[model samples]
Target: MGILVFDDMKMLDVSGPAEVFSEAGRFGAEYRLTIVSVSGEPVRTSIGLRVPADAAAESAPPFDTVLVPGGDLLPGTPIDPDLTAAARRLAERAGRIASICTGAFILAAAGLLEEKRATTHWQHTTLLARSYPSLRVEPDAIYVKDGTTYTSAGVTAGIDLALALVEEDHGPDLTRDVARSLVVYMQRAGGQSQFSASLQGPAPRTPVLRLIQDMVQADPAADHSLDRLAERVRVSPRHLTRMFRSELDTTPMKYVELIRFDMAKALLDAGHSATEAATLSGFPSYESLRRTFARHLGVSPTRYRHRFTTTRPAVDATRPALPDVPGNR
Candidate 1:
């Protein structure tokens, strides 16, 4: 395994995957980890730690897997040309290449993601898509696998991607042991949506779509079928769908379901039973709700409730807000 490092990079992007591979080695996996930079110098990580490099990228041996980690400065700022050149060289000598978090920016900059389906940190997925029209960007995936290139969501998703790589190299049995040792799920419950603003996505750019969205949010249990919604909005069903797809990137029915799903989560958080929440959220029955939960979250409603329901204090009014960090978020 070869890890490419640079200044201002998210510390965990490199360390998290390295830790997973290190733990897998304890179970008799022979994985050699090598860290490199362009000029064979130590790189300063996001948290002010200087990580020593094992060798320079120009002469490092070919790797079975090459990891490109993201930095805070990689997204908004123009990429350093030298760094892109080095990444291209390293990728040329690797069997497979994986980009962690905003590292997808680097890969996309090098033309590696052209014509490939990929993803990046959720907050930057739009910019990625806009910048590279040839790549299919999946904003909701935890990680995406496209042939020999892989791209993942933000910081901790790197660990998830590394776990998947371990499973591919070794087997499910060894991967399971590594996951147990690290105290993380062998498989995460959901995509990037679960950790982000699940209740809030992009607001509609036009009033027509906004009105439709408001109608769904106002009464999730209303007749939100495409035809009915189109009737309510005084447009044809096909036109309504075009309006939704143009602005919201989803069909009308899926948007209605998303609204109901949010209501179901709120009801469950208020201690309502799953069956009641299901009914109240417009689902026909508990089984329907369970299936929806599994599709969106990879877990049952009861299990999702249990996993996130530990008692806690209310939001602290005087607490400081989080500072804005681009790729690190």
Candidate 2:
């Protein structure tokens, strides 16, 4: 596999999959990894570490796969023409192509993802879709495979995409071993949303907003209507709504719902029944919880719990009965 690297690129975007493939090599897999740059010069990473390139893009050999890792490409900043051209050339000759995070922008610049279903970091998905109107951008996928071209979401999702590639090349057993060695799950489904409810809440900007959030979290079942919140904060309902929108980028009720959903997920992960979780988390009914789970998490509460619950090993029942040696009983 050939990894295309550039200045200011995210180091993990290149290293994560590189490490996976490197580990796979230890297990008897044959993966010849090469890091290439536009001119064979050492490139500085986003974190200020310098990485030496193995070859210039112009001289890099054709490979089974070409992987492009993302960088900090700010809006309206033009992609390097030489880099895009090299990607086009390499992609045209390679067996398959993939991009990590905002590297989709580079692929799109090279016309590799034209009319293709692709995804990028959730934070950049809208910009990508807007910039490349012809591309079918999947905002929620951890990674998307369209034909031989693959696009992955932000940072760590690249590892999941690379694992999928390894699984395709090797098999389930080897892939599982690789994942085990790396201490990450074998794979997260591509359709899983990139954001979890716990990670979605924006930080409260002011003491009033913080206090209101604390109160809502303290009692999810309380009457957290806009008027009630406004009364607690001594503000008009309209001002409260504006403040919430400004601070949280969401309405008051939506923030409350997010908190409730997060609490419900925690309850479910702790092995609570769905109906009980719904009741404790302030959902009006079990159906409401189900709908919220489906809407935001792309799975039912039961499925989410089953997928995410941490299991402990069961006790052995037939271990010689401990010899029944108690204190003179």
Candidate 3:
């Protein structure tokens, strides 16, 4: 498979999945992992690092499958037309195509995602849908495989998608072994938002914002109000609102809602009852939790768990065993 890393890329978007593929090769699977870029030279990463490419786009060998990685940059503008055209061409000939994170933006821009179901980082779902009206965006999944195209949400979720690919290409047994060797769980339940906590609420700047962050993290289930939070942090409500907008690029209420949903999903995945999870995560009631779940994930909480927590048939069931290649293992 060929993994393409574009300029201003997120490093983990490719590396995490590449690690899974490398380990799969170690377990006797045949893989040809190549990194391609528009120019043959190394592309700088978002985290201030560089990764060298195996070949330039013009001279790169054909690939059986293609993977595109995304970054923190905006997806709809300043993209290389040449790169988009190349991706379109790659999708035509490749057996399968996939994207990690906002790389779905590249595919959608390439016209590859039209009429196909895909997922990107949940934060960008509305933007992606608005930008590409033809593409159907599903936000509830960690990774989505629709026909020959695949897309995943967020950054590290790419690793989970890659393991699923290995499971499809080889079998569950080998997939399990690779996961065991990697020391990371092969599958994550629900979506990327589940694992994320408020950590630092809406990007702290002032000491007051820092205090508010601490309060949110300490008691996520509390009935936090703007006035109460402002009093706790010794700031006026108007001043607090301005600071939140300037630092977090979001409102205080919205940030609290994100934190509540994030923590609630985690608790639900940990086997907590929906009512308990709702209460613990600061939602007013279970009905409120259900409404938010439907709005953000497009699924009822029960349906989301049922779809993700349940297992599916192995992909290798209809396939023959792979032929042994000399020196492959």
Candidate 4:
């Protein structure tokens, strides 16, 4: 794995994945890690930490996988042309290419993400879509894999993406071990929206709207229909719908659905059965919950639980034990 680093890059964007791959090596996985930059010098991170580079981009050996990490690439901020060119060259020669967060911008600039489904930090998704219209920018995905190229959202999503790559290259057993070592969920229960739901919608403007939002969140099972909500707020149903559209930019029913979905997901993540979660989250029935999950998440509750659950199978006594690592014992 070759990770390209540069000035102002997010430190976790590089170190998080590096630690996962490094841990996999301890578990008997074969991974060769190298950090490179346009120049061979150490690069300062966005948080002011300096990390030494292994080699200059031009001098680096060929890699099976190349990752470009995100940086402070805000709007009107200039990207280094030399770095972009080097990334393009490395991507062309690598078996697979991936980007973390705003690194997708570099890949897009390199022409590597053209006509591909990709993602970046939610705050920057619009810019990426606007800048590279040919690229299908998925704002809410944790990560997207299109053929040999992969792109992920935000900084910590890099770890999730790296874990997924490890799972593909190794297997679930080893991947689970790595996740256990990291103390992170084997996989996140949902997409980036789970972490950024507040940012997803416009803030409630009026006190009535705010109160209704809090009520729905506190009790998703309550009557949250337009008529019921209007009654609670002492407004006409038409006026309530207009308020939701103007302030939330969504219908009242849509807001209720989002709240119910979040509540259901929380219950499922807590190890609740689908039927139990559905009934508790006001889905009417398990079938209703399943349909809602499939329509919005494109995955069944069972599948989501299987992927995201931290539970793992008992270790096989016959298999060789993992070697002890310093500080772990």
Best-to-worst order by TM-score is 4, 2, 1, 3
Identify the leading candidate in terms of lDDT. Answer: 2
Identify the runs in model 4 with alpha carbons over 4 angstroms from their true place.
74-76, 189-199, 309-329
For candidate 1, give the lDDT of residue 199: 46
RMSD in Å for all candidates: 11.7, 11.9, 7.5, 7.3
Compose the digit string of candidate 2's lDDT tens values, residues 140-182: 8888887789899998999888877776677667777887899
Cα lDDT of all candidates, in order?
0.79, 0.82, 0.76, 0.80
lDDT of 4 by residue, 49-74 (tens): 99999999988888888999998754
Q: Give the TM-score of candidate 2.
A: 0.76
Q: How many backbone clashes does candidate 4 have?
A: 0
Candidate 1 lDDT, 6-103, residue by residue in tens:
99999999999999999999987778899989988999999999999999989889887899999878887899988888889999988789999999
For model 3, which pairs clash? none
Model 2 error, position 276 (Å): 7.9
Candidate 4 or 3, higher TM-score: 4
Model 4: ten consecutive residues of lowest lDDT? 320-329
At residue 52, candidate 4 shows an lDDT of 94
Candidate number of the best TM-score: 4
